[model samples]
Target: MAVHPGDSPVHVALRTSDVDEARAFCRKMFYGPLQVNPVGDPAGFAFAGDVVTLGSITVGEISYGADVRVNIADLETAYHVLAPLNGSLWSRHRGTVVIADPTRAAVYRPVGDIDLEWPGDTRLLSVKVERAALERELDAALDQQIVSPLLLGESFDLAEGRGRTWSALVRLLHTELCAEEGLASSPRMAARWRDMVVSGLALTVEHPYGDEPAGLQGPRRPRTVKRTLDAMHAEPWRQFTAADLAAVAGVGVRVLQEAFRQHVGVSPLAYLRRLRLDGVHAELSRSDPWQVNVSEVAYRWGFTHLGRFAGAYRARFGVSPSQTLRERR
Candidate 1:
């Protein structure tokens, strides 16, 4: 789990000491029931001075990855960044995630399970931060009032991997915490680490170069795009169209399309569809299924076209919407 605030982001350095204790801790941390059967004994140990970690295989209920599990404390925000200096690890963020390796890295939000497994051994860093910590750190660095549980994106720059100071700092901190002593007092270390980290992140925020999406107005937009996004967010169940979006955004159809395309990367319709699909799928997968059935949930989310909705849901989440229903029992 990755945390932000300078002193409070939970930075834990765990050593593979007692396998039983480690497994139990993993179950508690990663949000999974204790495995009935252990997968591997980490055949051999690696003497990597960086930080060595024992690996395991995940079986049974596979919501995401089998290897790693995380359980977060309330008022705490967790972020997991796997720079996989090792071989490769499977990652699931929103839908069906891809495998990340040393050559590349991926980041997960405050919520979500992360996994890593290989035949032999592996090592990676897990970060956890209390919400207050992340908020205070980011606010101090950015000089802006930032809200808690602020969602740091899962996106990263591969071409610029390990090139920037921010990226390097993460590696250094995670690596150093790999010792028994390091993990024993990770919070203390993390506080200092968060201090340095917030400084770097603040520097990036000030520079505001290639960090966020292109054409990002950074608290500003073409008014039309802003209005359109607000409306869609307000009522996802409405019949939305380009003209409708244009009207709400206070612009013509062409301008609406251009503004959305420029600021948001996708066209208005595509963006709306993405939003609706994300909402509906999230309702299905993450929300309490007891409150609604598949079809009813779909309708509530404005998915009149069942086939189209199912297809989009499957494409995004790697499973059918009904699967969520089936698993409810």
Candidate 2:
């Protein structure tokens, strides 16, 4: 149940036989102040794990040699996913019990207490995403405010559909970061990978907005919609807010929003984001990666947040911004 063959390319962050030391390491690295108790002989207990920080996300491969029970009171500012590589994991979150294995994973939100039972010799790929980062990605995707404490399913299936694809993306991230010479060294590439992981989870897991369609096709464009579109296309790099776009269309913000939804199938800000993404793509396609990195191009197109930009770019273009830059033809 190893995450890698032989030895992992990612350096081990912690390896200890003392339960106190292991608990301290987990507190500092993954979660804050949790209780870990051995389920079997204390003498057989051991801990080994590797951890890496990618922007607002933390990825780790962890294993406790003996069976143990973990009690976490609150995750506070982050969301967690524990996907076992070999043995199954028993997790209780929000009053539901889930037996997570290779085919299924456990997801914990920021608000609730989590109890987990790890069987002997179980290895797990652990992902921690900051709450703000994940929620921002969701907000951007839905173009609206998200309800607090997102109702994510306690158990996620990793054997089919988007869950399977998300699992593969997580493994790929692990592999790249573990490699000696991988693209993850670049900040831009790391940001892109982090966004992919967060966005993938948002799309894969059961949530309020999960059932919404990708886009809505509406009727023909009106004059106000046409004016707003012209303004956005003409100055994609300008920092145009909803009020600014509405002003350009000679209407109130709500009227402009309704008009855009009726004609463009998205809000003015969302359509403007699409325009900015297109600008970045066009610039990256012609620029050399060695001379100009993805961030510079992204920033030039009014993308202040690299993680959100990467998620939006990939959602629109089916590839990362760095990939578009590297594979320019």
Best by lDDT: 2
Check candidate 2 and list the clashing pairs: none
Q: Taking the tens digit of each residue's C-alpha lDDT, what string does model 1 give over 106-162?
A: 555443434434323344433333345444555443312232345454435433633
Candidate 1 residues lying further than 4 Å off, grouped into runs, are: 1-17, 24-79, 90-97, 106-115, 128-166, 175-219, 287-291, 327-329
Error of 2 at 271 (Å): 26
As a TM-score, model 2 comes out at 0.62
Q: How many steric clashes between backbone atoms does each model show?
A: 17, 0
Q: What is the C-alpha lDDT of each candidate?
A: 0.51, 0.77
For candidate 2, lDDT tens digit of each residue in 231-288?
7767778999899998998999999999777555678898778667767866776676
Once model 2 is optimally superposed onto the true structure by TM-score, how far is the C-alpha of residue 239 displaced, in angstroms?
Answer: 39
Q: Looking at model 2, which ten-residue stretch has the lowest summed lDDT?
A: 1-10
Error of 1 at 35 (Å): 5.0
Q: Cα miss at 322, model 2 (Å)?
A: 49
